[model samples]
Target: MTMRNCTLFYSFANYGLNKKGRRTGKATLIHSLRLKEQLELKQKYLNKSHELMRTKNEINVEWDSSLSHANLLDTPCGMVPLDTFTQAQRQQLLLDVVEPPLLSTVNTSDFGKIKSRAKYKLSDWIKNDSFCDAGIAFIKEILASEDVVNVQHSIYQFNLFDMKRKSQRTEQLVSYINAHNTLIDKPKTLNFTNFQEVLFKIPIVNGIGTDIVSGKEMMQTMKEFIVHFYPDYPIKLMLLHDDERLAHENTGAHVHAFISGQNALTGKYDLRIAQIKKVNEFLFKRDGMSATLFSETGRLNYEQAGDVAKHMQEMFYEFVNEHLFHPKNINAAFHPESVRKSEKRKQMRKEAKLAKRDRPFNYHTRLLEDVDSLEIKAKKLDDKISQREKVVDDLESKAAYLSENCETLIIKRDALEQQCIKQEAAFQQNQRRHSKKIRLEQEVDERLSTKRKEEKKLDESILLKQQKHTELDSAIAEKQSILDRLSVMATQALYPIQKMLEHMNNRLILKGRAGAAEFMQHIIKAFSADLPTELRKTLIKITNNTGDTELENALTRKDSQINDSFDM
Candidate 1:
C-alpha cells in the first residue's frame, strides 16, 4: 500500500534553570483569557441552540478562574475589556506584561520585588535573575561543547532497536517529557530544568486508489516512525489536528515530538540533532513515504518568549471562535439567539423608562366650599382630641398595676427555678451512684466468667493427662506378657542340649575305658570334619596327649566305682 504524504517540523526550547521553561508571566494572562473565552463561547452556543438548551444542565461549560493571587484582577473575568475593567484588573495586566523581575542581591533591592511585595503579587518568581543567568550559562555551555561524533555508538551497543516495542499509546510517551503548549487536552505547567521541544507537521493525503489517509492515521504513522528510529531516546508526541495550514495550503494535521537531547541512560546533554535527522530521513526513504524534515535551535529571551506566547494564545482563541464555534454547527447556533434575546430585553427596559418620562402630571384647583369643609373638619378633630386625653390617663393607671403584677410573677419564677436546680442535683447524684453500682456488678460478672473459663481449661487438661496415663499402663502390661513368653521359649530350646550331655556322661561310666576311648576318637573326627582345617590341626596339637590321658583316668575312676558298688 502507498503510504500517506507527511511533513516534519523540528524545533527545540531550553528550560535551563527556569522551572517554567518557555512559559512566561504573560502565559498566565493568556491562559486566563483562554479559559474565559472558552466558557463564554460555550455559553453563547448553548443559548442559541435549542437542542443544547434542552440539556443545558447536563452540559459542563464552566471554567474555573479562581487564583490564589490576592488581587481580584488576577482572577479571570470573562471577556471584559481592559479599559472597562477595575483598577485590580489593570494591575494584573501590567504585572504579566512587565519585564522579567530582577534578582535580589546584598547590594541592591530588585524593583520588581518592591512592586510585587507591596501588591502581594509575587507569582512571577520564575523570571528572576538567577534563572536568566543560569539559562544563559547553559546555552553557552552547549555551544562551547564539541558536537557529538558517535551518537549512534551507544544505540548500537545497547541494541535498543532490538528491544521489545513500546505501546503506541501517546500518554505513555508524554509521561517522560514536558510538552508545553502543544498539548491542548489539559493545562500542563512546564517545570523541567533543561529540555528541548520539536514539532512535526504531517499532512494526510490520498494513497493508491480512493483510499484517503486521515489526520489521526498520519499522526500515528509519524509517531511509529520516530519511535522506531530513535528507540533509545526519551521522546514524546502530541498531535494537533487544528493546524490546517500544512503541505501547500492543504488542510492537514501536525505532530509535536519532544526529544530530550540528554542521553536517556546517563542523563547528560550530549545528544545532537544531526543523528536524529539522518535516521529520520533514512527511515522515511526506506519506508517509501514522502516526508520533509526541518529543524530550529535556540534559547528564547523573556520578551521574546512572552511575545510568542501571546501570539500563540491569539491564534488559539481565533481558532476556537471560528472553527470550534462555527455558525453551521448545531452546538454553536445558540450564540446569535442569545445576543438577540439580550438586545430585546434591553429595548423593553428602555421603552418603559421613556413611557414614564412622557406621562402628563395632574393640576389641583381649590373652591370656596372646600375651605368651609376644612374649617368644620378642624372643630370635629379638636373634640375627638379632648376625649383621647381622658382615655390616655386611664391607660397610664392600668400600665402601673400591670408592672407591679409582673414583678411579683418574676419573684415566684425565681423561687421555682431554685427548687428545680435542687431537684436536678439530687437526681444527678442518684444517677451517678446507680451507674457506679452497675459498673461494679459488670466487673464482678466478668471475673466470675474468667474463673469459670480457667477451671474448664484445667479440667480438660487433667482429663487429657489421665487418658495418656491409662494408655501408658496398658502398654507396660503388654510388654510384661511378651517377656514371660520369651522366657518359656528359651527354656524349651535348651532342654535337648542338656539331655545329650547327660547321655554322654552315662556312656563313659557304663562302658569303662573302651567307651572313653571311642568318645575321644569321635570328638577328634567331629572337629576334623566340621571345623576349618587350620582350626582342626590346632585342636589336635592342643589335646593330643593331655585330652586322652584325662579321659582314660576319668573312665577308670567311673569303672572302679561301679565294681566297688557291685562287690558291696
Candidate 2:
C-alpha cells in the first residue's frame, strides 16, 4: 500500500473504529463539546453588542411643559381655543407662547373695584378659579424692573375689560359708569354727556373682530398687566361697546382707557404722538394686542368724545338690561340730574317746607294760559298723526314687496337643494368607483407581490441545489480518485501472484512435465467434450494445444502477446 493509504487506514482504525471495526464514542463526545463552546462564544458576543445601541425614543425633553402648556387651557395665550382660532390667531398664540412679555408685579386685589352699592366684591368672587396666574408668573420673570407708571411722556396701553370673567368686573364697570354720570358727595347729577372721565387703577382688554380671547382670558391678561405696569397709575379703565360694529358672535368689542398715568405725574396732557405709537408697539410685542392709544388732542375732540361716551353709555345700559334693575332705580341712577323728582323726594321736600308759608295766588291765571296753549298743541299733534299714517301705508307696501321676494327666494332655495342632491349623488358614484379602482389595484399588487415571493423562493432553492450539486460533484471526484488509487493497489498486489504462476509454468515445461497451466487447459478440453456440441467446439478452439507452426506464430505475435499480458 502507498504511504498515504497506510496512514489513512491506521487513523480510521485508531479513532473511528475499534479492533472489531466498530465506531467509538470518544470522538463523538469531543466534537459535541467543541460545537457547544463555539455557540456559547457567539451568544456572548451578541449580548455585548446589544447593550451598545439605543433607539430614538430613549431621549427626553427638558422644557416641553412650558412650550406646550398653552394647548391644555380653554384659552391659550389669551386667545380662543386652538381649534377655534384662525391662522393669524394661531400664529399670534405661538409668538406669545414662545416669547411672552415682561409682567409687572400688579396684584389681583389692586384691580379696579366697583363703586356701586352692590354687596358683592371682586376679590371674593369665585368661578375664575384657574386664572392665568402661571402665564402672569412667566411674564413677570421676563419684564425688567422699571417704573412704567412714572416714566415721563411714556403712554401705557391698557387692556381694561374682559367680558369672559364677569364675576365683579361688570358690576365694577357699572359702578364706575354710575360714578361718572352721578356726582359723588353731591345730590345725583346724572349728566352722562357732561360726565366724561372716571379714574381707576385698572387695565382693560376685549376682543375686536375675533372671538379668540374670551372675557375671562382678557380679564386675566388685564389684571396681570395692571398689576405689573399700571400698579402705581390711576386705573381708569373703561369698557366701550360699539353697537354698530358689534358682531353677532361677540366680535368688535374693545376696551378704552384714558391715559391717566402721565396726567397724574405731570398734571398736563402729553401731546407726543410718539408715546401712543410706542405704547401700541409695546402692547403688540408683549401680548399680540393692537392697543390703540388716544392722544390728548384726539381725546379733547367733541366727535371722538361723543362716540366714546355713547359706547360707554351703551355698555352700562346693556348691563342694566341684563341685570334687570327696577325702573325706579334706573331712573334714579341714570336720570338723577333731571329736574323731575320721585314721589318720595317731593314728600320730603313738602315735610321740610312745613315751617314755610304756601304761596298759590296765581294758579287761576296760569290755568287759563295753559288751556289756550293746549288747544294749539293738540292741533299740531293731529298733523303729526296724519304723517305717521302715511308712513305706515308706505311700510305696508314694502312688506307686500318683501312677501313676493320671499316666494322667489323659496324657489331659488328649491333649485339649490336639487343641485345639491345631484352633486351628492355624483360624489357618491365617484367615491364608489374610486374605491373599486383601489381594490383592483390592491389585488393586482398582492398578486405581483405573491409572484415575487415565489420567484425569490425558487431562486433561493435553485442556488441551494446548485451548491449541493457542486459539493456532490467534488465528493464524486474525490471518490473517483480514491477508487483509482484502490484499483492501482489491487493491480500491484495481484502482479506477484501472476509472475509466480508464470515461473512455475516455465519450470514444468523445461523439465518436460505437464505444467499446471497445460494440465488445466487439457482438463478444461476434456470437460468441454461431455457438454453440448456447440459449447464443446468453442471450448476446444480456445483450449487446443496444437503444435502447428502457423498457430504458434499467431499466438507469438507481438500485438497478441501484449494484449494477453494486459488482460492477465
Each prediction's TM-score versus the true structure: 0.20, 0.14
Q: How displaced is residue 549 in candidate 2, in Å?
A: 99
Evaluate residue 429 in candidate 2 and report its C-alpha lDDT on the 0 to 100 scale: 37
- For all candidates in order, the CA lDDT equals 0.34, 0.31
Give me the candidate number with maximum TM-score.
1
Tens-digit per-residue lDDT, 39-125, candidate 1: 223432223553344332221111111211211121232212223454465445434332222211221223323322422221222
lDDT, model 1, position 131: 37
User: Cα deviation of 59 in candidate 1 (Å)?
Assistant: 22
Q: For candidate 2, report its TM-score.
A: 0.14
- Stretches of candidate 1 above 4 Å error? 1-21, 24-193, 202-211, 243-250, 273-568
Regions more than 4 Å wrong, model 2: 1-212, 219-233, 240-248, 266-268, 271-568
C-alpha RMSD between model 1 and the true structure:
50.1
lDDT tens digits, residues 464-568, model 2? 455445545554445435434433333332232223223323432332334644544433233322233343333234322221233224323533444455579
Worst 10 residues of 1 by lDDT: 359-368
